[model samples]
Target chain A: MKISARNQLPGTVRATTMGAVMAEVTVDVDAGAIVAAITRGSAESLELKVGDKVTVLIKATEVMIAK
Target chain B: MKISARNQLPGTVRATTMGAVMAEVTVDVDAGAIVAAITRGSAESLELKVGDKVTVLIKATEVMIAK
Candidate 1:
């Protein structure tokens, strides 16, 4: 699917940690591991599991730069 | 400064677009151009301009993933 976010890193799921309302999914990418915090409902809907392939998305607005 | 955010990409400033409250700063990284929307005050404080070296940061909680 097409997304507006500029950063898209393809990776394999490494771990999943679910909280009451949020879930953190760790993905192993070429650079390293990236952790994403998403809604538990979305996680459940996606049925995310270890070894599954996914793409991490980050919006340009949510990005920050340090000099 | 040390930050907990996992994704940190080093790049050079490419452009800057300022609005009333927020400013968009584009950085040219190894991957490509990454845009960041920051408060105009912050942008001014940093004195961001073209050709400046910087590091793009994204928090884990602000990230999402798709299958």
Candidate 2:
């Protein structure tokens, strides 16, 4: 599917934690692992599993830069 | 609306740049500015404008921590 987010980091699913309504999914990228919290429904819809290839979409109006 | 993402950072819209299909929206947070690339439709639907309050939703299975 096409998304508006500009940053799409390809990574592998490292782990998943299920909650009553939300689930935490982790993606291992070259730089580091990105953590995402999504609803259980979305998780099931995505069929996210360990070793699954996924893209991390980040759309923030502001990205804090540190010097 | 209820979203699955765990990280929701509250900030103000600093700037917005429109593109053919996507738009770049900048948010100014306490720590820093987060840049988000979103679809024109979503942007307009959200009625995102300068000085608007927004919450950045981030959902990933893993979060990398650096030293």
Provide chain B TM-scores across all predictions: 0.91, 0.84
| DockQ score for model 1 | 0.63
Fraction of the real A/B interface contacts present in each candidate? 0.82, 0.15
TM-score of each candidate? 0.78, 0.51
lDDT of 1 by residue, B23-64 (tens): 999988765677898999999999999999999898988889
Off by over 4 Å in 2: B1-67
Write the residue-wise lDDT of candidate 2 on B1-67 in tens digits: 2333556688899999989878889999888999887778778767789998787766544346789
DockQ of candidate 2 compared with the true complex: 0.12
Q: Which stretch of 10 consecutive residues in model 2 chain B shows the poorest summed lDDT?
A: B1-10
C-alpha displacement of B62 in model 2, angstroms? 20
TM-score of chain B of 2: 0.84
